[model samples]
Target: MKIPYRGVNAINSREIDKVLILSGTFGEGHQQVANAIHEATQLSLPDVESVVFDFMALGYSYLYPLSQYVYMKGIKKFPRLYGYFFQKTRKVNSFSIKLNAVLSPGMGRTLKLIQEVQPSVVVSTFPFAAGVMSKLKQYGLINIPTVTIITDYTDHSYWIHPLTDQYIVGSNMVRQALNHQGIDDSKISDTGIPIRPKFFQAHDKIELINKFGLDPDLPTILVMGGGYGIIRDGLTTFRALNALPQSIQLIIVCGHNEKLRHQVTEEFKHSKHRIYLTGYIDYIHELMAISDIMITKPGGITTSEAMAMELPMLLYNPLPGQEQDNAQFLVHAGVAMLAENLTDLKTKLLHLLFDPKLLKKMKENTRLFSKKRSTFDALDVIVQMKRQVSIPNFSVTG
Candidate 1:
């Protein structure tokens, strides 16, 4: 049996009010941002339809798996090499431009898909998709307005495309970085990272705790070990939390990692704190609502969700690329604290718990820092771009 993709068949209208969102499957952040934009469009503009497609699947059918394997393995086994390449190609220069040209793939398939979709505007949550769109526009193949949403806080040359009409970024820091990279400031909007509307909604903490059958009086700490269970030394972190002198409630979300889930379950069976173990849950907003603090990897979408929920975060062991950049930005913004190791994790967690004033300050900072209207802002950009498309037909100008 074949399954339908998300937001693909949301509308059956033949009208021109449609957004073609191109994303990738290399990481969950890109796809999640696409879905968030799709969700917001559906909720806000009933007439405008947003269709999300995994550009890798649509374009590079056979090479997708191999590329994913290489990327995941390289990040896990050879992170230094990955980070080396990341840093080397971070700035737009002669070599970085050539590197981007080589990395930009699926141009033929991208143009074909755009023609079939006939969208009013094209939005890319993935960098390569934006690259493809920009190349097509440069060649005069497609005349639609294109917007690229940078999913992470860091700026890199990979996401920069000359012919791209606009940029929707996560923060002012990234906007400034892009401007310094020679991108026009007028083309960029600091809209924050798009997340689902549910994250921005007010959830009752006591009611959520009752619904989850967790203790209401005890302070709740939500620990998220990423989508692939990639929190560094996760077992050690769990042990440190279990060893805390304060009696608290632990909500462990070991996403899509049965091995990690089983191991954590076995180890924490007789722990002092009340432990609730789950895997790949859909109710993360609910969990965030009930928690006083969250110990998580600082992925773009997750951190945005935490900030939207106004929850203080203990960012643990971020990988040495955009994740590290995100951690630094959050730490500087006063929304999160970074922990480099097991000791640092325990110490920071204790400080947040012991000092209620600090915790409250972090939560308040989140309120000031979070862009709760990010989804709508992105939707507004898409709508404006759709309205701005004036050219009737696009042709290759050789």
Candidate 2:
């Protein structure tokens, strides 16, 4: 199944022109990174035609929704259980090996997609996709250059595979962790997590504040859940913050969770301070621009966006696995703080909001830490890999 070339003249002239981005939807981070990379490739490398495929939807259509439900239920109701499983599989073990083996049957559809796309380079933003691509390459079924973008701040054995040609990591710490896991230093590039270009662009703070109907003089706190608005105890957190002595403004962006949005609106309708509630907004960059600090869960893409905005984060009740790791990294970096419960959240938020100097220092740390052009940097790595590699005719087998 050879895919016919359907790109521009410049693309047709080059040996490498198409990019296949494989992503999954267990969390929004994977899909967001896939979209960021696709946008970046289109903007910077005009000749490259990037295609994003939802690997789970394509490969396991029957189980995708069920798997998502289980994942969400686990995170929301059984975080400790999720954490236990996460820790158990943190290192390569028999359980992890068996899990990968069980998932291998689904890779047939992925292999078929590869046959149809005929891409010059394959990139995976999801661990499952990476594992499948690694297995395919290991079996000599695919000869395309394969890159895995680690979307989290930590390293896990599930992300490490034998046949991946390169790795794009979020930070030096993640790269170091990967090194300790035996991945070659040269294969890992600390390009940061890829974020949309809009986040990289400068916007006027006052202008954005005015645009959002926010008072420029008042210190604003931005609250967020990931794309699904799965912030644990979000209403309680808000209630506690509203009880604070300071006259602060709050802007909560509840992403695609109408129930959460309605609950928050009803809960804060008569609050003393100015509270802005919105659902699934596309202008997070604008909201981040006007806020003094963020109270949110520490998902990789969201945290990366906050860091890029140089907005100090109060990681409120991060979940057990990657979110916990992200919180630890940010706290250690001094650009963020962690609040495990309601009492701690109130205490930390008050101290940080009242102390202007501390906020400035955190902002400076964020400025030093952010990788503003990581999207472009990741694209550059892909283009370079494409230029250096020669596509080979390979055979597929079960």
Candidate-wise lDDT, in order: 0.86, 0.85
lDDT of residue 250 for candidate 1: 96
In model 2, what lDDT does residue 158 have? Answer: 84
Error of 2 at 371 (Å): 1.0
Candidate 1 lDDT over residue span 208-307, tens digit each: 8888899988989999967776777757778888898989999999887788899999899898888888998778999999999999888998999999
The alpha-carbon deviation from the true structure for residue 168 of candidate 1, after best TM-score superposition, in angstroms, is 0.5
Candidate 2, residues 1-398, lDDT tens digits: the string is: 11122322233233447888888878788988998998898788877888787877777788879978888777899888888888898888999888766764566777777776677888999888899888888887887888999999999988999989999999999999999989999999999999988898899998888777888788899999898898898678778988988888999888878988898888888888898888877789889988999999999999999999999999988888898999999999999999979999989999998899999999999988899989999999988777666664334744
Clashes of 2: 0
Where is model 2 more than 4 Å wrong at Cα? 1-16, 103-105, 394-398
Residue 387 lDDT (model 2): 69
Clashing pairs in 2: none
